[model samples]
Target chain A: MKMAIAKQEVRALSGDEAVAYAVKQSDVDVVAAYPITPQTIIVERFSEYVHNGEVDTEFICVESEHSALTACLAASATGVRTFTASGSAGLALMHEILYVTSGCRAPVVMAIVNRALSAPINIHCDHADSMVERDAGWIQIYVENSQETYDSVIQAFRIAEDPDILLPTMVMLDAFVISHTLESVKVLPDDIVRKFVGTRQIPLVKNHEGKLVPFKLDPENPVTMGPLDLYDYYFEHKRQQEDAMQRASQKIKQIHDEYGEITGRRYGNGLINPYRLEDAEIAAICLGSTAGTAKTVVDQLRAKGVKAGLLRLRAYRPFPAQDVTKVLENVKAIAVMDRSHSFGAYGGPVFHEVRHTLYDAATHPQIVNYVYGLGGRDMPQTLIHEIYKELQKILETKRVKKPVRFIGVRE
Target chain B: MTAKQKGWKELPIAGLCWKPSTEYFTGDWRTFKPMLDEEKCTKCLICYIDCPDVAVKWKPEDEKIEFDYNFCKGCGICANVCPSEAIKMVLE
Candidate 1:
């Protein structure tokens, strides 16, 4: 079911540059962001676009990440497209407003260059920053490379702004790995991207005056947003957020397939991308750039008659529980690799979710957790090979002696 | 008759406050209510300007001042701000 790609040009761009270029062509109305490592280039390049008269986006340089997200939330409340980027401490600083943005249904799209959280003050790549905010009600998408970064950034706006799923979204790229490394990205023409994104469709809501008006902060038809809700209605609002998240699983896939038809590029049904897993006896599940390396390992294992496969999770927030269950139900054993660890929890975030997702399946695979590459540590091909080997051994032993293992770390 | 409360599905997508704040009757929580002494009251309208809840009502055409006890939290700001000591805080 492959479709022909329309007119496109191949450009060598890093992950950050790809996000900026996609946002520039998407015709975002406003961008408010504070600069941080790995993600700084995105706003910096977009500001250049603003200066060169390439795009008429309102580029706002805020004092801090908190104010940056606050400004974007306010701008988005006015019913216009808005974007921002952050990583590491900057993402952490914008933590409080993340909940506010999604709770208010602002539909603001952000690019998070995945970086290790501080204390050690490392600026390298890891999922800890965004992974910690997993419950903040944001749609999270992790990309494998610069090309996916570019494609996903364009798709994020449509997914977040869908009328049925007006939730904020975060497009993640590994810091320094994809953010600094350049790759050949096929970009659709500006007009095509513009046409594909179209305009945000705001739903009509009844204001206090009993008149139906667009759900935005308009002087002509005023409405209060992010109002204080006590016990009387707070639970209902939280339930509505959960319902929108449930609906987002389907809406994201629909939007992904629609975009694929126009560009001939699609990632595994827009939720989890399965690689060589059709007849695989053993598989490894991971998120972000590590999947690219793991795929090479799987190919090498296949060459040696190993029935190994990889399932790269693209969307983490929605969890894609049913799809994951259907895909891995028959596999003999699985290794879930997480770049971020949940302190005092049973395992890493992805491992816990995947195991929970498979709890009721007809066939239970011997699953293990591997916390790897914290603080921007490199996950080489050998480590991925080690994981597959461990899975192979677990399949034979019929038991997991250790449910969790720290990869590439000295005892 | 009271309007029926909305279910989660029928309510606005987010917890958007579309109804005016006047919809909630906060005065029920008030233990002390403000009482005005019209005899000693000047036409200064100090209570009307000092009330935080906008519960003090003053009509320019009628040249009259009244209290909207429905929303008043009885903070006693009006009684404290009355220059002529024309307002008193009475237990509800």
Candidate 2:
């Protein structure tokens, strides 16, 4: 008889449940939360955990999203991990404090739970809220499915707490698509989650001969922070943030690979996850929940004799300029599906930036944006096929379609 | 000597050099300005306690308090929250 080795089992979970599971796994000593559209349920389960004694955390019921983040930041700053969730108006309230947490480099992990911004108050699925905060310095990882949402939440702690990148991250998941949807997921055990995430070392603090001195700053050897800089250190500060942003990409990728080893789940966070683009003519560049639809469209298009591919973006921050240029240079056409509109000048924020990044390149593909799903419009996979066909037409005739291709809308 | 230079000797302790006739965010010039009326006054430290931004300071001598305007943003909350109604927002 052959001896069998002991191995752990995996289970299925919905996005909200997965989030609660992830929060539990992160060993979050404090849970600060407020009720907001789409993201409310994620914290609802967390509250249940606290009530049932499933999670031993100081669950702080906050008045508003601003206080939720403030409490999370304050808690995490004092040498313990913290978690929270918000979307749309709630996120807007927390906007100013987001930069403060980033500036202070607090490793408070949160789930943005992507939803459409208010006014008419329609909430389903869109990247509007998350895209609006592109420069908040929070490392964003947009997930496509419920399993990935759960997985991304777990991975967020590992990535955020990395000493080289002691920065907060917002795991952005589509409101109804992933946040409310149910899917089979492998929820890692708490012990394994603890082992994988490890302990976080609080930032800007160091002990010297029994005295607690701040790490990133000097008080006894004093230095002022955020001083209104003239020409001297202004550029240097910008360069410092840019360098950290650059370093974060590689750190994120390394953590992804490590998580893959430990948990058998990995996310390609290097801006683009290229599918069948090795010898393809056109590649569809997309981000967030739309990538799932685009991937299916790519398979169908490929089956019907179209030499096209997919580049599902996972990490939009520290935008992967070099990799995008290198991979997209030789392609005849690249259709960027923009779920977020930039109002004018460009169709969407991600589409606008990607087009600009690839514009000056020698053999770059003709980039066209398909701005779809605004105010929670339906984006069927068949529309992605139509968008790709339109891209093919644009490739044949070099005529730009007003810099935007609005697909399947009443207007 | 000019009256401005002569004024320093007349001041009590820690001869004040700060100005309040100028402003930052709010335009009320003497918004945080110290008024040493030395009349109709009970110099309680209530103003200092109500100041969220710590714009007010309490001095020990004669229980009098002076304002520092070099860093004050002239938020006007100080004057509005003053219990004694001693501080007033005035145009420069």
Candidate 3:
């Protein structure tokens, strides 16, 4: 069914309120999340929905994200749609169960308000937390603004629950950029959202008594899920996950396209969002909220007639290896702007994977890594411009001391 | 029309420290064993339901079942689930 957008008054909403609207629009049966900032307000508002009986969901106040997702695990197992949200440390707490949620093939979608991992304590945006968890088998969808944050999460449920792609997915927005930005989001009417999202009818296997139950997951389908996967079947499980992931990238695109048809909102989901790359000799690769700043830099560079483009990665896991190859193969030079770094790796962790994806290509772009915005460093548009100019010099010099550059470093 | 593959393994009380001298499990005396009746044997599927661990593996094709005591924490679920009265609990 086509969505009917109402001419609702354009009111400013915090990122958390956008998430609450998305959850209610999707008609999520359960919201099991704990308190953590900037994420605390999301569930706090959801708790209000529970008390007011506006949303008939089991709004569970879990002890931790681990417990929240664990309860979501059992809840999703019984075949109810579920949601939860968390930030850096809370995302870290649910690390082990994240694998379980995906391995069990539970289609649980979550919103992650991107926060810097705590030590000296910063609560703004960075790619460190989710970037480190790139192999956890959940599709990571990054939104640049609050409007996309509100939209992507509802599509997260639709994509995760699609039978062709029954895996968990995480919708991410920077702690401040989208999480704090107020935009005029055209939220589809709830009933229209319902039409786009059909009611879930899980197959019921009746027990001997009149009451029905799910038949035990039988091996007769010749599918052994989450088994020990000893040497005999180990490679196949990895292969299946990889296969499912490649399929998931395409699935994400399909979901985005369908959501586009419904609400005139579109997201390019093949790892990177390419802008002005049609025939550019140089481009900047970025992820998360940095993309918003990077886009401004791209505009300034273009205004100066600098042949530049921007590749904003939206899906980070399964690392979009193939898609990165196709997009970056033509550009003469590329500089990766990263917000997180591996302590002693050749470059920041994000740079390492983007390079790996291009390793086997026939020809490769001159890729360089720039680690910026560490510990809440303010990476404004000019610094991003300076970094691109530096990449220009490196490409011009044709010789570099190292492939990776940590931009905005005081030292 | 055809029989499913039936696999079995002989589990021994080694490394697990199944010492008969220790009269109670961890000295709590809550753990017990479900003694099976060799005579009054009707293969009813009750004990499988009551096992908290769901440890009782009743093979419908072969009509044979076995238990791995290592994982069986003696919850006595099988004793309660057995409708044939073919099982009884013996304290550790």
Best by DockQ: 1
Instruction: Evaluate residue A154 in candidate 1 and report its C-alpha lDDT on the 0 to 100 scale.
Output: 96
DockQ of 3: 0.04
Clashing pairs in 1: none
- Candidate 3 lDDT, A139-214, residue by residue in tens: 8888777777887888888888876566789988888777777777767777877766776544433322323434
Interface DockQ per candidate: 0.61, 0.03, 0.04
lDDT of the structure predicted as candidate 2: 0.72
CAPRI band for model 3: incorrect
Q: What tens-digit string does per-residue lDDT give for candidate 1 at A309-395?
A: 999999998889999999887798999999999899999999999999898988888999999999988899988999999999999
Off by over 4 Å in 1: A1-4, B1-3, B28-51, B54-69, B74-92
Please state the error at residue A51 of candidate 2 in Å: 1.2
Model 1 chain A worst lDDT run, 10 consecutive residues:
A1-10
Ranking by DockQ: 1, 3, 2
* RMSD to truth, every model: 3.2, 9.5, 9.9
Runs with alpha carbons beyond 4 Å of true place in candidate 3: A1-9, A201-238, A269-271, B1-92
Please give the lDDT score at residue B2 for candidate 2: 11
Docking class of 2: incorrect
Error of 1 at A174 (Å): 0.3
Report iRMS values in order.
1.0, 18.7, 16.1
